[model samples]
Target: MYGGADGAVAVLSVAEEQKHLLAYAPLVKRIVRQLNSQVAGAIDRDDMEQIGLMGLLEALRRYGEPDAAFGSFASLRVRGAILDELRRQDWRPRAVRQESHRLRDSVRALTRKLGREPAEKEIIAALGITAEAYQEYQLAENAEQIGSFDELLQEGMGQADSAPSPEEQLMVRRSLEQALRGLDEREQRVVQMYYEFELSYKEIAAVLDLTDARVCQLNKGALGKMKATLQSA
Candidate 1:
């Protein structure tokens, strides 16, 4: 449909865009690697990398120079795209979802009855589960909740329709800061390093002299508490 000069310009434009995408390839890989650490074994790294590449392409199409730095913006887009894919997969078993709901309901009921957060033993006794079973439930619930929180963060980062206005964003930041204060020193530090400092789990573990799994546990607990606080606020 184009004349010779117009066709040549279109070809050159496509070539330039391809070159830009190639330039950002390493960034995509890094993001995939970082997110893959958290969800290892849940999804294949190669698949996640493919999702990240799609994200990078989306970023290239939508990004404007006056926005944030390209690397940071692109990273957020990549992470969001990967997380969106995970959400689409809905890999959690239906039974697991039902159990998580029951556990949440029990917690809410116990809190209402006691007028405070129930202790671990109290919850276990209320649920009529052995300590070992309760621990398993906690671990599963933590993983599920952390996944939800990650989705929340990803949505906040990338979705324009879901994004908060500046005033609302400031309010959320303040509320989150207040909620973080409710955590112990170590929990607060773990959250700050992981989210604010953008440190990987292993990196955070090394800095805090803890194992990777321990860091994950702490992060899960912190997010649970933060979510509760934010919801109450």
Candidate 2:
């Protein structure tokens, strides 16, 4: 419901609706296949594809049938639907969410005061947290930051759907571009390889000569910095 020409779609006969759904069925499968490859052991591919198909049906109902422009518009809705379900099934407890907020706020405050990103030791001191606790915070931060990166990638693809005007969309694009430009070269390459090139984490690691976990860390750090910059804009 974040956006769509929802309710503005022209009503169609039952036969027409079925035909359109059948036509877009492949798109749902394609999306599920890509997401399933990334999260192989975590979610059932069949279930994800079912959800994606349902999402496509809803998009048809609310945003109308297939058109040249409908694919990108429906793509956003389908992704949102899947991500919403994923969030509902998230394993994080309430306390973890709270701690992430605390860590994020502390880092933001420290950055403002220090006029630079805070070091791990400085952050530990600022938050009066143990090294182990700081590491936990980092894990929490990575989860949230990487989730945000998905939405950011969608925006970059011109698939943003918050009902912005053309001028507003332009500003958002500029802000995101500026934030991306601020990334270090390695971080930039990591992001591009993962998103634009649609490479798996393992594949990106092999190309970058780093471990899979290191690639995730680099991406997390890069997204964190871009998030801060984007918020300021």
Candidate 3:
């Protein structure tokens, strides 16, 4: 029994990389959905899925740090991989791209006009899309678009990096680090996984021995807390 147990451990160790990639497939899908929401063009969900898979593969191949959760690390890789593909597609027609931009503008304008989130119907009407053609046009226009990496990376950097002097920058860094320390361990882990390490919730849950719901709750609560703290500070 001891020998068999040892043999099983060896097998599992060898298969860990494959296991990691398989484990985070669902996370890729969720991220893709998020990307879809942000972009305009024929950016099909399937295309994002494929890109995510490629990213997962790369992450698996390059995975380091056994102490870190695989999902957390792979999230960034998957997102980056998906975006890289979008950037490479130089063959997207000019008219289609233009229309996509216009559609986004329309959506934005309607949102402001209504003082709330606009529905698909409102977007279609604003874009002059016919009922019969709206679905097709929307799908096509969104297929080429995915989430932008720049926005994700720069979200809080502007405020944090605006310090005028080296001493001020150091002070800001220390302050941010101190603020981060006040979060609960789970919140710290979630934030690290999602932003710093780039793990998906699914992956973080697996590594942390928690459910997906709990991971999300902790993340959301942590963000809300952080935002409130920042605002008050």
Candidate 4:
């Protein structure tokens, strides 16, 4: 679909950039593939790849010295670009969000009516929705919860424009530390594996012998606790 002269220039630019990047196109592809799977069939893999390549170019420009850390630095920027695009896509349409709200409202009403939490059967009967549909609703909410938490984590990991003063930096790290302590042992491990080690949820699930869904749930719970702590701070 690329036209004549502009297309040639783009191709040449990418070729030149890749040379300076030390041929890190594989890293971009890996990140895009991993993220595409989690997007639930929303974004086209090719489009994400293009965004990732642009990110790598930006990384190389910003990173004047291609030292030992260039690979790590470029990887973060590439992944960040793809993640930002995913958020912008907001694959969950307005209809899906409205439906999620309705589902939560129904569950709340059922719990209040029962004087306690309602069982799955009770919920299905009251809402007249299939179990699979209910699961879809839960999945939507869980995805959003973890996505927000990732945005917070990404910013904390040096994505800011202006560097904070020493005191401010210490305070921010302390806030994160306090927020992390609110998690359980396993949840702490999950956070470390994610933010420290930069492992995917699927990878974490394999290491912990838990399903991806279980890992997401743990992160979602941690997000709730951390957000409350941050708000109160």
Alpha-carbon local distance difference test for all models = 0.69, 0.69, 0.59, 0.70
Name the TM-score of candidate 1: 0.62
What does candidate 4's lDDT look like per residue over 1-233, in tens digits? 11243322123355566687557888887777666656676778898899988888877665543555556557667877877787787887899889989888888998999999776678878999887776666667675664465456445545432223344456667988999998899999987786556677779889999767566667777777887887787
- For model 1, the stretches where C-alpha displacement exceeds 4 angstroms are 1-23, 37-40, 64-68, 128-136, 142-184, 197-233
Task: Report the poorest 10 consecutive residues by lDDT, candidate 3.
Answer: 1-10
List ranges where model 3 is wrong by over 4 Å: 1-14, 37-44, 65-69, 99-233
What TM-score does model 2 achieve against the real structure?
0.60
Backbone collision count in every prediction? 0, 0, 16, 0
Residue-by-residue lDDT tens digits, candidate 3, 1-233: 10232222122343775676567788788777655543544467887798898887765555432323445446667787877776787546788768767766777788999999766567667777875455445444434422322223223334311112334335545655665677998788877776555565557879999755456556655665665554455
- True-structure lDDT of candidate 3: 0.59
TM-score of 4: 0.65
Q: Using lDDT as the measure, name the better of candidate 1 and candidate 3.
A: 1
lDDT of 1 at 153: 48
What is residue 94's positional error in candidate 2, in angstroms?
Answer: 11
- Give the candidates in order of lDDT, highest first: 4, 2, 1, 3
Tell me how candidate 1 scores on lDDT. Answer: 0.69
User: 87 in model 4: Cα distance from truth in Å?
Assistant: 3.9
- Tens-digit per-residue lDDT, 1-233, candidate 1: 11243222122355665887788888777767666666545688898888888887766665522133456556667777887887688866789778878987988899999999887779889989877666556555555544455554444344432223345556656877888899999999998887656677888989999767567668888887987887787
The numbered model that scores best in lDDT is: 4
Task: State TM-scores per candidate.
Answer: 0.62, 0.60, 0.40, 0.65
Candidate 4 versus truth, CA RMSD in Å, comes to: 8.2
CA displacement after TM-score superposition, residue 227 of candidate 3 (Å): 16
